[model samples]
Target: MVVFDRADDTLRHLARYWGTFRQMGDPKRSPAIAALEAVLYEGRAARIHVIYDGPTTVGGRLIPGAREQFSTGILARASAGTWQRLAPKADPAPKSSPLPGRVHVVQDGDTHPAQAVLMTDAEVADWLTATAAGET
Candidate 1:
């Protein structure tokens, strides 16, 4: 299973979804999303989960249909935060199995430096695909 972190931008980049135009700027599939979806289509990923910070409120007014956009495996901000906190920490350099159901954050200069995989989107995608296929 692959769990994306701070995936608001990724959700916004869904090519099929256009409701998030203003906030997201463009309704095109991001490179990362595209690569992942390709892998999914090719029957590579066993399970895919995208968790984002969602259901945002501005000036105490809830955004219409914000929660509805996230129909698949989307957790509310509070719930996701709690899950993240409760989730087990991943060692930066594991001696044995590299990915034993652990979170590998895809980002540059992550706040939690220890758990982050500091790599470009394409690099991360390639690594994930190779690992999933037991090619790495």
Candidate 2:
């Protein structure tokens, strides 16, 4: 959280934007990629919390195939698993813990409620606990 002109003030603009490029192009130096890169640049006081919860590919390219675009070491896979047993309407609990992989971003707050997302590796639980009670 970079403080912009916060010398005597604590108020600052919070930028929580998400990007998705589902077209074909040079992702390495693409405009959208550059914009994200700039936002996360060092000494910029801008903290971009990147969450790969959207399309798996950028510019219509697969993640494993887009080597050049993700050359900045910003990509990594996580370990996630799902429950094979069904939940009981009789209030039965499961035995194993859920995996983590899902990502939820509260961009608009209570103004727009985020859609339901099924992620693994405990990602779902984390997101659910993040913004409790309301959605914008």
Candidate 3:
């Protein structure tokens, strides 16, 4: 299970590996493969999780109840009875003055909340994706 301090980072990593699962061609019989696509296209700003078992050709399968947590805007999957439990660590910084209609951009790998930036949603997403891909 991998946890990201920022949602965008999670999405970027997921998108990069999405193609690997698409070749499988079916989700119902392959929950793990299907889940990857589902999360990449439908996931939102919430905790995102993914699970992968060995290739179905190798006799692996996704487990049930793998998508139960953070369902409203999160994604999860499991295979071979194993699931990745990726979750963000809670930020520990003290809150600052409340800004009306402001969006907070949390830093990826930020162990403390104080390091996060106050930016637009798009900026946050871009930062996450770029960071996940090992870009500056």
Candidate 4:
């Protein structure tokens, strides 16, 4: 889970996970809403990320989670001053991500950093296929 430190523009780049409302699909998948709520309500660091992979201890029992490297980024922002107080003092694992403090949220699908490209349905399909093939 990556807790990016976004300031307005950067916060608009990434996507947030709104739980699905049955088969109707994502009920509140709105980046704008996330950005607005996060910065306003959660402060700037009240977000969360759920990493679903490998073996993690849930309530003391160790169980391997799902494949596909699934993760969710929360837009919940706490107080900017409290980010350090609330976040981990140090990352516990080699690949662990610290609760982010302040960083730019770059646009997704950007090639040159300055230019953005929206993926077509075919591209999305190919990406999923590649991930499933373990080629990514």
**Candidate with maximal TM-score:** 1
Reference-based lDDT, each prediction: 0.39, 0.30, 0.39, 0.33
User: lDDT of candidate 4 vs native?
Assistant: 0.33
Q: Model 2 Cα displacement at 73 (Å)?
A: 8.9
Q: Rank the candidates by TM-score, best first.
A: 1, 2, 4, 3
Global fold similarity of model 3 (TM-score): 0.20
Give candidate 4 regions above 4 Å deviation: 1-113
lDDT of 1 by residue, 6-95 (tens): 444544545324433425555343454445444434333444443444323222222333323233321122233443432213223222
lDDT of candidate 1 vs native? 0.39
Q: Give the per-residue lDDT digits (tens) of candidate 4, residues 96-122.
A: 234443222112212111212458889
Return the lDDT, model 3, position 57.
18
lDDT of 2: 0.30
Task: Compare the candidates by lDDT and give the number of the best one.
Answer: 1
Error of 2 at 13 (Å): 30
lDDT by residue for model 2 (18-127), tens: 12433555343345434434543432243443333232233333323322222122111212221111111212222322434322222212111123445775876676
Model 3 lDDT tens row, 41-88 = 445434455333222112222223333333222212322132122223
- Clashing pairs for predicted structure model 4, backbone only: 42-77, 42-78, 43-77, 45-78, 46-76, 46-77, 46-78, 47-76
lDDT of 2 at 2: 29
> How do the predictions measure up, each by TM-score?
0.26, 0.23, 0.20, 0.21
| Backbone clashes in model 1, listed as residue pairs | none
Error of 3 at 78 (Å): 34
Worst 10-residue lDDT window, candidate 1? 69-78
